[model samples]
Target: MEIDRLTVRFGELTAVHDLTLNSDCGEVLALLGPNGAGKTTTVETLEGFLSPTSGTVRVAGHDPVADHDLVMARLGVMLQSCRLYSAITPLEALRLFASYYRRALDPAPLLERVGLTHRRAIAWRKLSGGEQQRLALALALVGRPDVVILDEPTSGLDVEGRLLVRRIVAELRQSGTCVLLTSHELSEVEKMADRVAIIDGGRLRAVGTPAELAAADRRPEIRFSAPAHLDRAALASHLDATVTQPEPGRFILALEPTPAAIAELTVWLAERNIALSDLSTGVASLEDVFLRLTGEHQPEAKGPGQTP
Candidate 1:
């Protein structure tokens, strides 16, 4: 999929601004951003549910807006919200949806893959939040679509449910299905996504593998313990780094690059003969890079009629 300078506007407000990104076949590209950051709008456009105000969107070499039917045939979508027959059982629901596709996986195995086989006869309304999410995923996979778009697939899921979802995602990738997922779970994204795109304020900020983004803003971090009476200001002035006291006697430092910040700091501390405790240096994580780029340490605006 490729979106070139894609822009979407609602009245005078721009939901997506000049966004351009692409995903390779069979790869998972995660969209990371807070709510109202245009992640949903971008995905909706690619699914042919909404047309862009300007720019072009191509999915599987077909324009989604212009070739809605063709794109729909090869795509499976599990949106954040879906309406289903509350009275029907899980098996019945899957059968109903499977009937619409010319080629689909067997309903039984599909249910088992999603861990809903045991609840085949349970009413849809009787399932818990996590169960419902899993059912939604099963429905999306019913058609064996070449590309799958999942929005918040693991929301409200317990640890077990989350693990089930991750396993299913891995299986999808192994089968050569391109997966595009939108998620707020940083740990999940870090584990499953082959590449990640950070969107904020309706604009594309950065796109790369988790490691690439972390390396792009690479900084040496040091953690050490000091005496309660030790002057932090004096210690900070002596080292070539910025210090923060996360707790009494515990300091976290971001060292500036100058000839291997870690080595320099080691020499400086050694010169003072100050024995440090619990010191380590490493690159920033996807979560750290995301916080730095978007400045969203929490969720953003809720969708219409949805709770924040």
Candidate 2:
């Protein structure tokens, strides 16, 4: 799928402006942005739910607008919120969805894969949120589509449910299916995405692998073990960073990863007779880059978890 200079407008408000991105079989491209950043409009345009006001969108070599039926056949979309018929069982839902496609995967194995086998006979309205999410995922895969577009696929899921999504995404990539997904879970995106596109205010802000974005940001953070009352204000004055103690006996210093800064921090701690143990450094994260481009303040990441 390719979105070339795609633009969408609502009256005088331009929702997505000249957004260009491309993905192919065996790749997972994550679309990330702050609220009101036009990701929804762009994804809807690609999914054929809405026509682009300008520019072009192509899925499997056919224009989505002009070839809606063809694109719909080749694509599976999992929207953020799914409102299924209240009385339908999970088994019934999958069976109904499978009938839509010329050839669909059998629902029995899919139910097991998504951990919904136990809930297969339960009414849709009786399933828990995570179970419902898993069922929605099963429905998305029922068509055996060549392209899958998922929005917040893991939202409201438990650890096991989330792991299920990750496993499925990996399997889909291995099977050479094109996957485009969006999620607020930056940490998961950092781990799963083959490439990431960060957009803000209807414009593409950055696009790269997670490592590339972090390297470009050049804000390295040092985490270490020290007392809670380690004088964060004094440490902040020593480097171009804000130091904090998120837990007792644990300290984090955010700054540019310069040798000079490292030496200065070491020397300062030594002078104060404070033993800074378990020091570790990390590059800027997706959250950091997101905050930088979106002009929003995300809380400091909760961990490097003692460097192991």
Candidate 3:
């Protein structure tokens, strides 16, 4: 899938601003941003749910808007809100949806893969939130689509539900399905995404692998046991490090890039004969990078049909 200069506008507001991105076959591209960042608009435009005000969206070499039917045949979508008849059983729903496609996977095994086989005979509305989400995912995959667009597939899910979705995405990748997913859960993206795009205010801020983003924002931190009344200012002045208090009796020192921060920290502590405990070092995470790039505030979560 390729989106070049895609733009979507609603009256005076532009939801997506000249966004360009691509997803390779069998790759998972994560759209990371807070609510109202145009991630949903971008995905919806690519899936043919909405036409772009300007620019082009191509899925599987076909334009989504111009070739709606042809593109729909090759694509599957799992949006945040999906409704199923309350009276229909899980198997029944899958079979009904499967009938619309030229080719589809068997409903029984597909239900099993999504961990809904036990509930295959149960009513759709009787399933839990997580179960309903899983059924929606199964419906999306039943057609064996070449491209899958998942929007908040794990929203409101428990830990187990999140794990199930992650496993299903991995299986989809193994089967050579290109996936474009939007998610607020950093850990989920970190685990499953091949590349991540940070979108804010309807614009792309950064695009790279998880490791690359982390490395780019790398900062070393030091932890040690100190007196409860230890003068943070004095310690910082002495070592020339920025100090942060994460908790009572716990301090983190951010060091400069001259040398290994840990090495310098160790020497500074040794010179003062200060005993350190639970000392560790590591790189920044996607969440850190996101916060640094988008600022600490989270955008308001908008409901469907609301203009971004």
Candidate 4:
């Protein structure tokens, strides 16, 4: 799958801007961004639901819009909204979708793989949100697609549901299917994705593997929870580096968290009689990289109802 210099516009609003990305078979490339970041628009173009205003998007070496039927045959999509009929049961829904593909997996084994065997007989409207999500995944896999797009696969899922999805993703990777995943679950993305593309304001910001992105910002730092409204300037002066409170009572010191730096921080807190809690040292996290890249105060992962 490839998107080369892709741009999509909705009249006065530009939803995507010269975005270029590609995914090879047997890779999970995650598209990470807050709401309104053009993730849905990009995916829609790839699915042939929307045409690019300029540039190109291709799935299986065919232009999605011009060759919509051929692209749909090889591409499986699970959008944020469930696409199954309300009255349809999981088993029935999978069978119906499977019939569309010339080569398809059996509904029974697909149901079991997604841990929906117990709920296979339940009506789509009667199944829990997590159950419905798993069923959607099963439908996507029924076609044995060359590329699959999963939006918020783990949203509202329980621990067992999450584990089931993770296992299935692993199996898909082993089977050499290209997977494109979008989610707000940063920790999960860090675990499942081979590469992550962070975008904001309808433009690409950064793209790399979890470790590469984290290591991109080489500065190590200490994070601790303390009373809110502390004097940041004084702390910065003492540490001789930048000090930031990403959230109230949560502080980050942009200095190497070496033994000496840690000791100095402790002594400073001791002298000021400030209580400290939850102190730890680490390099940048995927979450930290996302926040820095997007500059969003609070990144909310929701369906792009407000997005153009």
* Top lDDT prediction, candidate number: 4
Q: Report the Cα lDDT for residue 34, model 3.
A: 78
**After superposition, candidate 3 runs with Cα above 4 Å error:** 219-253, 257-282, 297-308
Question: Residue-wise lDDT of candidate 3 within 1-308, one digit each (tens)?
Answer: 99999889999999989899989999999999878899989988888889999999999999888999999899998987888899999999999989989999999999998888999999988998888999999999999999999989899788888998899899889999999998888889999999999999899989999999888877765545565555666666666656655435556566543456667666867777776765644666687678767765333222233334
**lDDT: which is higher, 1 or 2?**
2
Off by over 4 Å in 2: 220-234, 238-260, 263-282, 298-308
Worst lDDT 10-window in candidate 3: 297-306
lDDT values, one for every candidate: 0.82, 0.85, 0.83, 0.87
Put the candidates in lDDT order, highest first: 4, 2, 3, 1
Q: Give candidates' CA RMSD values in order.
A: 8.2, 5.7, 7.9, 6.4
Lowest-scoring 10 consecutive residues by lDDT in candidate 1?
Answer: 298-307
Clashes of 3: 0
TM-score of each: 0.81, 0.84, 0.81, 0.89
- Candidate 4's C-alpha runs over 4 A off are 225-241, 247-249, 270-282, 297-308
TM-score of 1: 0.81
